[model samples]
Target: MTGRGATTVWHEENIKRTFEWSAGAIFAIPLNVSCQHFNVSKDEPVRLLAGTNMPHLMNLFHNEDFIFRNPFRFHDRFSNDADYFRHNKRLTVRSWETNLIQDVNAFPLDDYPMKGKGVRIMRFGIAGTTYGCHIQEFPVGSRSTFHRHGPGAIVTVTQGTGFAMVWREGEERRRFEIRPGSIYSPGDLMYHGHFNTGHTTMRHFAMRGRSPKYSQDRYRTPLHDMIPFEEEPPEIHKEYLEELAENGITEAVSVVKE
Candidate 1:
């Protein structure tokens, strides 16, 4: 704790503290805990990314009080799947303090047709989680269809390279390259598409709400105006080239020749 806040540590018998984190460390914090993050380095900038399953709770109920109270206070008391007992469902808020992926390829992939493209996905293991996360892979030179949904999503690129094109209705398309450790988000209700420009398969881990009923009926594909790979807009092409050059990427493709 710093910057005008009290540096007080709670008296929890089992609490232990350590300050060792690497490049790809994933950590979690329990709900209603007092915690602080600090950057000890003075010359280098520290970037932090955060993810949570709070959306699942929001989708389950609308009461503001539920945020502070336990949602599953009596979860074990009932076996009924009724609406009233939804708050009684099993809920967990703890995760490995220093979780690391031993091997990305060890996980099995499940391929399915989504929005006209075959997508390979592998769900991560996080028991009692309400949010679903998986590693998604796109084969070389393939692209996903233009799709939109109400739930926002964040994808972190882990392997190969690609680019994501995002746009809203009546808005100009924005292109961004998907490099290793790169993160992209399709803002709520924004139509977005992804393309694997690299020669190898592109892999990214995606996080979003797991409940199908959450923001239901908001996912759509406006295929009528979907842009084809061969007919990609000239402005979008120009932006793609600019991003590649800015990021020191030498790989370039000719849309017309493809």
Candidate 2:
């Protein structure tokens, strides 16, 4: 999450490749690959946040030697190609078919008005993994529509400050304060929304349970699962305005109507 670093990845036949990264960089290691990380900066410490499906795999296999020491190579997922880690900008709809993102905080995103006013988003996959992620941004004083999905999404604030409200249906809403580097995950099927109270645009990265491209689940959330602004509880907007006022923000840009 901070400083600069390099990662050395080893593949079959002793093939080795290294890539450098800085803050906001995102990449995935190929499944079962041997890799090592180095902090390139001498005086600064490098901090990184990573999520994995290893727990699920371990539970299913329940064998350390089979899970960790297996020699099977996923050649289709990764190779020793020199450009394996290069940034790919190709977009299919809102999805970027890339193995790496150089800087997610600055990556251009497409308008996603369905989620909220002034909202933009870009989904991406890494190393053909089912655990992919997306980046979303919204202007200050704006908030996203309330929505819910399955569990296992790690939401990390990449820029600006904000707060999120999470709750189950018919339950009391719980608020969580967030800023750059903050991380939180909503429970399974829990409703959640994010409000931006900072001066600059708010951006966050959500590493999700399954990639949209490769998901096989039959019970994914439907479009109707989202709660429209007009249908939301009146107290939501009132609370958002109070937050903005507390931050000394007199004008509520892109604030949804109650």
Candidate 3:
């Protein structure tokens, strides 16, 4: 072969290896990722992201349960590790004392410690499903401080309008307005945050599965933010640039600019 042809072959091989390496950690497909009870075919199209390689590829392969009434389905994760998400036993009738419920902010909870926290959750016997949703209303001109999810959550806007900035912690942030139907199913891990950007109180619905007090694990935490993702721990700054490229935005986010 010509030297130029050999070089081309070598470069192509390198590109292929990068493609495989970049995809991401291999997760053993869990048997029960579906939140629905229906069976799914293994032959269906599945998109497993190459790490943060394909941010647009939201859902992964193998098994899913369709939401009771919606076309969107939740994947069933049957791993022993996944099974231990604690939500049902989280709030017991007796657990409520002092006319309040514990661990729950009491927005609508009659007697929960998380009073005004979000909303009361009804139990779904099938595990790994988020039964309850909560909304934190942000008054006009107030932005939620940078924070990340303690456990994974799926969010939808119920009322009000605002902008949410999602990014790897400390990276360039991308802001999107939360409209009546704006929805996001983010990756299971990583430190991303939001901002409420509107003139009125912003209300949103979030579905968070039961997670152990320490499950998924968190590092540094402040008294106010009850989450695991920290901003000061140091992460890839390039994520911001990648986000900018991925989202097709050309302007820098002035999150810190006055």
Q: Which prediction has the highest lDDT against the true structure? A: 2
Clashing pairs in 2: 1-47
TM-score of each: 0.52, 0.91, 0.35
lDDT of 3 by residue, 99-202 (tens): 11122222332221221221123221223322233344443333343445554467665455656666565566466667655777555343444443443444
Most TM-score-accurate candidate: 2
**RMSD of candidates 1 onward, in order:** 9.8, 2.4, 18.9
After superposition, the stretches of candidate 1 with alpha carbons farther than 4 Å from their true spots are 1-48, 53-106, 115-118, 211-258
Tens-digit lDDT track for model 2 on 1-258? 669999998876876999999989988998878999999987889888898999999999999999989998898888777888984855465677777788988989987777887888988877889886899998877889899988888999999988999999888999988999999999999999988999999999998866756763422445447898888898888888897999998767655442
lDDT for each candidate structure? 0.52, 0.84, 0.34
Q: Tens digit of lDDT per residue, candidate 1, span 105-213?
A: 3334665344335456644433233354556677654556566666568888777887888888788877787787788888877878777777677777777655222
Q: What is the lDDT of residue 93 in candidate 3?
A: 32
* Models ranked on TM-score: 2, 1, 3
Candidate 3's displacement at residue 190, Å, is 3.8
Stretches off by above 4 angstroms in model 2 are 87-91, 216-224, 245-258
The per-prediction tally of clashing pairs is 1, 1, 31
Model 2's lDDT to the true fold?
Answer: 0.84
